[model samples]
Target: MEMAWFVIVTVMLAMYVVLDGFDFGVGMVYPFVAHTEADRQTVRASIGPVWNANEVWLIAAGGVLFFAYPKAYAAGFSGFYLALILVLWLLIFRGLALELREQVDHVLWRQAWDTAFTTSSVLLAVVFGTALGNLIRGVPLNRDGYFFVPLWTDFQPGAAPGILDWFTMLLGLSCTVILAFHGANYLVMKTEGLLYQRTVSAARILGWMSAGYTVLTVIAVPLVQPSLALNFSRNPVVYLAPLIGVIALGYSLYFRIRGRDTSAFLASSVFIFLMLVSVMFGMYPNILVSTTDQALSLTVYNAATDSYGLTAGISWFVGGFLLILTYQIYLYSQFWGKTRADDAH
Candidate 1:
């Protein structure tokens, strides 16, 4: 049951990344791709109908974490309190920017919101990537299974490490580039004429950059945490996750070059999904690792709630998942195809 919940949580988070990730990518590429007010509107319209709905997956994943793995959830929230607060603020600003950008006709008003949107989006991507890096690199957990990290401590992933280490920063940058690449593909699929051309050009450059950084991140992962590969070594089939991710990334670029916008976007989605799957595969059993002591790490067994709770929650979870899935399908179908600046919400 605990393991099931772990898989459930992983899938939910991965869904959040693949869904809302393009929204973030849109924000990241907005300034570069949007030159005129019409261009900005088109970009906003492309994501306007679905961005908020996409974030529901993140909220649902957090809720499940709190319910299914209360111990790890509590520890992680408290330990990363500052970082979480920052993320919350960024989310708020990004939301406000999206909602308020067209409230007034003033150029300055729209520009202010535009800046906020792009800045918040880029920062959120970096923070999220850094959080993953911290997880992979381990935290300074005590015997009590809780730890606090400052923003930076000599920028190193030592026994007593900070959240913004060199390794985490690298992943953060990589995430930014990858999301930009992802967003470009999405825009390519949703726009026409000059907008599509610009996005295609951006996607081409960002694609190669994302590929390069992915390679660096993959190499750095094993160096930072050798234990992450133990499961892969034992069960070689697990390697397929990353293998598929790389193939998807290659296909995204190939489809982009062939001017197949939808195919490229779908390929980028697959790449993001499979890459996250690889991370989950690498971090199995242990939900949170401890830099202080491996014994203090929170595994699924140690961190899960009572068996009764897990069993009861599954039924509710299934029903809720179905409703959400249906809503998502309907939402996308309604919004399918090219968007125009006049369509901005």
Candidate 2:
């Protein structure tokens, strides 16, 4: 039951990453993709209908964690309190920028919000990637299976390391680049005219950049957290996730060059999904690893809630998720084609 919930949580988070990542990527490159007011409006229209719904997955995943592993949820939330608050503000600003940019007629007003949208999205991607790095690289958990981390310390990866060590920063930058690539792919699929041309051209370069950084990060991972090496060593089959990620990445670029936006976009999404799958595989069973002490790692069994709670949680989750999935399908179907600046929200 615990393992099942872990899988559920992982899938939910992965969904958030893949679904929202392109939006973040799109926002990051908003200025570059748009030359006119209509171009910017069209870019906004492409994501306007779906961005909010995409974020619901993150909230759902957090709720599941709270129910399934209350202790870990508490510790993680408290330990990363400032970071979480920053993420919240980013989400808020991004949403407001999208809504208010259209509501105001003044050029300066819309531009201000546009800047907010792009800046917030880029920072959010970096923060999320860094957070994942911290999770994979482990924290300084003590004997009681709890730890607190400041923004940084000595810029190291060991027990008193800050949140922005060289390794975590690498992970953050990797995520940012790929998300920009992902966003470019999305724009190519959803827009027309000069915006499409620019996005397509940028996507190719960004795709290669994402792939290169991913390779560098893969090599750096073992050096930053050697324990992740133990997981790969134990389960040879787990390597398939990363392998698929590389293949999807290459396929995405090929499809993009061939002018198949839909295929390229799908491939980009798959690459992000598989990348997370590989990370989860490498850190299996351990929700939060310990850098301070090996014995303090938070494993599935150690951190799970009582059996009764998880069993009840699973039953409720299944029923609620089916409804959510149905609505999402209907919503996407309603807005399936290319978006124009004049399209209604």
Candidate 3:
């Protein structure tokens, strides 16, 4: 039951990344891809209908985590309190920027909100990426199962690690680039005219950047923290995660070069999905590792609720999941196809 709930929670988190990730990518690269008001509107239009919906997955993931693993949720939330607050602020501002930007007529007003939107988006991406890095690298969980992390300690990995560090920052940067590429690919599929060509160019450039950064990060992970390599080394088949990622990346690039929008976007999504799943695999049996001691590791078994709670939660979750899934399908179907001026309003 614990394993089942863990898998369900992990899947929910992955769904959040795959769904909100592209929209976050769009915001991160919006300023770069959009030169004029019209360009900005089109970029906004492309994600407008589904951006809010994409965000719900994150909330759902968090809620499920709280329900399924209350202890783990308490530890993680309290330990990363400062970081979580920053993410909250960024999300709020990003949403406000989207809604308030067009509410005013003044050019300065629009520019201010646009700048706010892009800034919040980039920061959100970096912060979220760094959070993932910390998870992979492990946290300084004390015997009490909770510990606070500063923004930086020694600016290095494996030390009394902080919220930001060289290795973690690299992950953040890689995440930024990867999402930018994803967003650009999405734009290619949903846009037309000169903007389409610009997005294609952006996608192509960002794709190569993402590939390079991904390779570098993968190489550095083991060097920084050897524990992440334990599972893969013990079982060679685990290598398929990275292998599939590389193949997906190649397909993304190939399709992009061939001017295949939908395929390229799908490939990009697959690449991200594989990479995240690899992380999940690497850190298996251990949801949150204690940098201070291996004995303190939070695994699916240790961090979960009692079987009775889990059983009840799982049944309720299944019903809610199906309803949400049905709504999502209907929503996407209603908004399917290229976004244009009509979606901007």
Candidate 4:
């Protein structure tokens, strides 16, 4: 039962990443993709209908963590307090920007909100990515089950590293570039004219950045987590994720050259999915690993709720999934097709 809930939580988080990650990517590249007022509107319209709904999965995942795995929820949330607050602020500002941008008629008012939206989205991606890096790279979890991370330590991957270490920072930057590429691809698919061309250029730039940085990060991972080397060495098929990612990168280049926006955007999504899965696979079982102490590693089995709780959670999760699935299908179906000038929320 615990294992089942573990799988459910992982699947939920993965679903959220694949779904909301693209929309967040769109917002991250908003300023670059849409230079003019009309262009901004088109970019906004492209993701307007889906953005809020995209967030529901995150909420559901969090709810599951809080209820099913309360220990992890408390430890992770408290340990990463600063990051959680920053993420919340970003989400709040992004939400306001989405709602208020259209409500105001003044150019300055709309532009201010648009800037906030884009900036928040960009920062959110970086923060989220760094959080993942911190998890994979492991934190300084003590016997008390709580840890703190300052901005930085020595730029190495060894014991008791800081939050903004070179590795984490690079992870954040990699996330930002990848999402920016993802967003640009989305814009290329959803909007046309000057905005499309601009987004295409932006996608090309971000694509290269993401590819290069992701490669560097992948190479650095085994160094960061010596235990993960076995997953690659013992099970060669695990390498397929990165292989698919490279293929996706190639598709991004090809689609950009051929002006195939939808294909490019879809390929970018695949890239994010493969990368995320690779990371999760690398850190299997261990939800939190302490770099300073091998004995302090927190595996999913150790962090899970009791047997009765897991059984109850699974039942509830099934009902919730059906409800969420129904609404999501309706939402996407309603918003399908290329966004138009006349489309308004």
Candidate 5:
């Protein structure tokens, strides 16, 4: 049951990344792809109907984590309290920038909101990537299964590492580039005219950058945390996840170059999905690693609630998950196809 919940939570978070990731990507590339007000509106319109709905996966994942793995959730939230607060503020700012940008017709107002949107999006991507890095690098979990990390400390991932180490920063930058590429593909698929042309050019450049960063990050991962290699050595099948993810990224770039926008977007989605799956595979059972002591790591068994609670939660989760899944499918179907600048308002 704990293992089941682990997979469930992983899937939910993966869904969030694959869906809302492009929204972040769009925001990251908004300024570059959009030249005039109409271009900006077109870019916004591509994601407008579904961005908020997409975030529901994050909220649902959090709720599931709280109930299914209370210990891990508590430790993660409490330990990363300051970082979480910053993420919350960035989310709020991103949403407000999206919703309020059109409230007034003033050019300065729109530009200000645009800047806010892009800045918040980029930071959120970096923060999320850094969080993933911390998870992989392990934290300073004590015997009590809780530990705190400052924003920075010696810029290293040693025994008492900070959140923003050199390794984490590298991953953060990689995430930004990857998401920018993803967003560019999405724009190419969803818009036409000069916006499409600009996105195509952007995607081409970002694709190469994403690939380079991905390779750099992959190389650094084993160096930072040798256990990842040990885990792969134990379960060789897990290697397929990242292997296929690389292939997917290659296909994304190929399709983009070939002018197949939809295929390119889908390929990028697969790449993101598979890359996350690879991480989960590498860290199976262990929800949170302990730098202080391996025994203190939060595994599925140690961090989960009692059997009764987990069993009860599954019933509710199934129903809610289905409803959300249906809503997302219907929502996307309704908003499917090309968007125009005129559709922004």
Candidate 6:
């Protein structure tokens, strides 16, 4: 049951990344993509219908984690209290920026809100990417399963790890650029006329940025997680994820250049999926690892609830997921195709 719930939660988290990720990416690129008031409105209209819906996956993932892996949820939330608060603040401000940006007609008012949205979006993406890096790099979980990391300690990858380190920051940057390109591609695909042309140019620029940063991240991963390299050496199949990611990225570039919007966006989603799978596969059974002590590793089995509880949880989880899947399908079907300006408020 614990294993089932873990899989469910992981899938939910991945869904959030693939869905809400582009929205966050859109927010990050908003200021630059939308040069004028009309352009900004088009950008907002492109993401407005889907932004709030995308977040539902995150909420669902958290619910499952809290219910199924209560211990891990408690430990993780408590240990990462500061980071979580920042994430919450980013979400709040990002939402406010979206809702209140056009409420007033003044130049200063619009500019302030746009800046807030962009800054918060960038920060949110970095925090999320850093959080993922910490997961792969492992935390300083002691015997009590509690640890706190400040912004920086030594500014090195593994040397006295902190919330922001060389490795994690690079990963965060990669996430930022990748999402920026993804959002750009999305805007290009959805919007027409001048908005589409701007999106195409932005996509090209951010696409190059994404490609360069992704390469750096790929190189850094094995260097930062030497054990992962060792694991890949032992099991050559693990290399497939990165290989597939490279291929998908190439496809994205080709499709974007060819002006094939849907295919380009699809490739973007695939790239994110392959990259996430690569990280998860590298980390394997360990839910959390200790930077300070190797013995304090948190594995799925070790961190799970007991046998009977897990068994019952599995049944409930499966049922819930089927319903969730049905609803999601219906929702997407209802909102299929490109959103028009008339459709948006």
Tens digit per residue, CA lDDT, model 4, 1-345: 766666677777877877888888888887766677777778788888888888999999899887777777878998899889999999999899988888879989987998898888888889988998898889888887778877777867667688877778888888888877887777777876777778778888888888798789888778788777776677789889878977987887788778777788778878787777777766767778888787877777777778887886677789989999899999988877777766787
Local error of candidate 5 at 266, Å?
0.5
Collision pairs in model 5:
none
Overall local distance difference test of candidate 4: 0.81
- TM-score: model 4 vs. ground truth: 0.94
Local distance difference test, each candidate: 0.93, 0.90, 0.87, 0.81, 0.92, 0.81
Candidate 6 has its poorest 10 consecutive residues by lDDT at: 336-345
What overall lDDT, based on C-alpha atoms, would model 3 receive against the true structure? 0.87
TM-score-best of 1 and 2: 1
TM-scores across all candidates? 0.99, 0.98, 0.97, 0.94, 0.98, 0.93
Q: Taking the candidates one at a time, how many backbone clashes does each contain?
A: 0, 2, 0, 0, 0, 0
Displacement of residue 222 (Cα, Å) in model 2 is: 1.4
Worst 10 residues of 1 by lDDT: 226-235
User: Worst ten-residue run, lDDT, model 3?
Assistant: 336-345
Model 6, span 20-42: residue lDDT tens: 88988888778776777677887
Clashing pairs in 6: none
By lDDT, the better pick of 4 and 5 is: 5
Off by over 4 Å in 1: none
Give the TM-score comparing model 6 with the true structure, all chains together.
0.93
Candidate 1 lDDT, tens digit per residue, 25-126?
Answer: 999999998999899999999999999999999999999999999999999999999899999999999999999988899989999999999999999999
Q: Indicate the TM-score of model 1.
A: 0.99
